[model samples]
Target: MKPMKLMKEIASDIVSLVYPHICVGCGSVMPFGGGILCAECRADFDEPVLDRCPVCGRIIYHRGKCRSCNGTRLYFDRGHSVFEYKDNVRNAVLNCKYRNMKHIGRYFGEIMADYAEKNALCGFDMVTAVPLHKNRMRQRGYNQSDIPAAMVASRLNTPCVSALERVVDTKPQNFLSREERLKNIKRAFAVRDKEAIKGKSILLIDDIYTTGATVNECAKVLKKNGASRVEFLTFSCRAED
Candidate 1:
């Protein structure tokens, strides 16, 4: 091996010894070259997705179209997701969102970008995140979805645009019934720069996809403001129930 390369590796090893990386999933010290998650945790995050809704990408019972997609109209054309939200996948998401482990977002963002690449889902006019309300943003110190969205744009060679804003501080959607979720998110978001999204095909990024209420509402607002098309991608989603 080149002497300089060997030296650099030694230096990296020394630095790692001094400040080791911690696995976010189990809070264990990470080995050299390990990812944000350890191998076992990665297995958890890699929960297999057998089948999902074409419109919302949630796991479905029988598979033609998910019951949710059939029952309620989705505003976005279609969607893609990376993992089933359960076990360590759920733990990782919660840790990233509430535990200040922002690097987890970057890690998942790379995976999301890879999924887009392998699936031929790139080449969007813009990539954007479902915005947090300014209040929520301040409280949380950041929006968990923002980093992944930005990372995806960087990976896909596109612009990451902040084209929408959460206008209302709505209650958490998981706590609400489907109908209540619809009502809660009504007018919950507003487009920031209509011209930026107008006539553009946009990819909306988020951390999770549950009932589709959040992305559907965001898509509705974007389309209403003149966007040509809108589609969503998420890190994890609810499995078949």
Candidate 2:
């Protein structure tokens, strides 16, 4: 190893010892060389659980599918999420999306990358993000989903394709009821460049999966424009059942 790089690593270790990194969920001083979180918190995080809905991959217990997906049409071939969006997961997403905490995005992206590696997510030919309308993009200054999408695409060794465009200025899905959400995003996305998606399997990346309305609608547009298959990776999902 280069001496300069080795020195930097040693210095970083010394700094961590003096001021231990804090855990995002608990605010406790993370143990030395313990990686992202302390053992206790790591144990508490119930990841890699198999109890998920077959279609959307949200956590399902006893119920066949989450109520949000029941009787609803989905356009994607499959969907997967890293964690259930509750408590710490919810706040972490809000912080990254609305509070400009981009490090949170990178952290969640690492989790998604791990899941992708374990679950053989390298089959997709291209990757894309859920598009934000021009108006909303201007208001937010950045697309929250793009950050994690970039990270995951980089990890998956695929080009992140910006193939979909949000031509319609739809109402915010969070502010609307279930019926209104479907109405708001219907026909909201369009595939601008056909050549990029034609005959390719595309992975759509997003920060959160809620009613499956938004991602499914985007997938429908991509498939209509000749995408062979559409799949998704999301950071979090709510218990809609």
Candidate 3:
């Protein structure tokens, strides 16, 4: 091995020894220093049940489409999520979003990639993330969704496209009611290049799905710009019991 490369590896090992990596899901020091979750935490992460709405990806008793989305005019054709937004999974998501633990996003993205492949959800032409407004991007120093979107696109051998931009800097959606969320997010996103997404099937990526307001707004803009279909893949979702 090159002497410089060996020195760098040694330096990294020294840093790891000094500051051990803690699992984002459980706050335990991972036996293996490279990953974000301990094995037990990964195993215990809550997942949604099989019976879910095909359109909204919400947990439902019966198959096909749930009554909530049956007559609703949703912009996205379908949605899929890896875990229910609760417990350790929820903590991991919060860490990824607000705590600057972006490695967790990559980890979750890999999980989403596996889920998509196993469930045959890899038919989209391109993958794009719900873009963050400039103000939010400046405050956070990164768009959390971009990490997972790029990772998923890389895993699926599809192009990751930044085809949308947040034109309006709206308030955070988590504290808002459904009606408020819909109003706040409407007309907030604009397509970057209509020709890039024209008639293409798009897989939109985001970290969480609360009321589906944010992703739906993004899908609305994408479809308006001639995207043939817009589907969503999220890390965690607010599933109804």
Quote each prediction's TM-score: 0.87, 0.81, 0.86
Q: Which ten-residue region of model 2 has the weakest summed lDDT?
A: 15-24
Candidate 2 residue pairs that clash = none
**RMSD after Cα superposition, model 1:** 7.8
The better-scoring model by TM-score among 1 and 2 is: 1
Alpha-carbon shift of residue 46 in model 3 (angstroms): 6.4
> Candidates sorted by lDDT, descending order?
1, 3, 2
**How much does candidate 1 score in TM-score?**
0.87
Best by lDDT: 1
Residue-wise C-alpha lDDT for candidate 2, range 1-241, written one tens digit per residue = 7777577557645643453365555557776655545565565555556578878888887657766667877779899988888766776677666654545566777888888888888888888999889887765546878867888888899989898999999977777887888889899999989988999999999988988889999999999899999999998887655
lDDT of 3 at 203: 95
Better of 1 and 3 by lDDT: 1
Residue 30, candidate 2: Cα error in Å is: 7.2
Error of 2 at 97 (Å): 1.0
Quote the positional error of residue 132 for candidate 3 in Å: 0.7
lDDT of each: 0.83, 0.79, 0.82
What is the Å distance of residue 170 in model 1 from its true position?
1.3
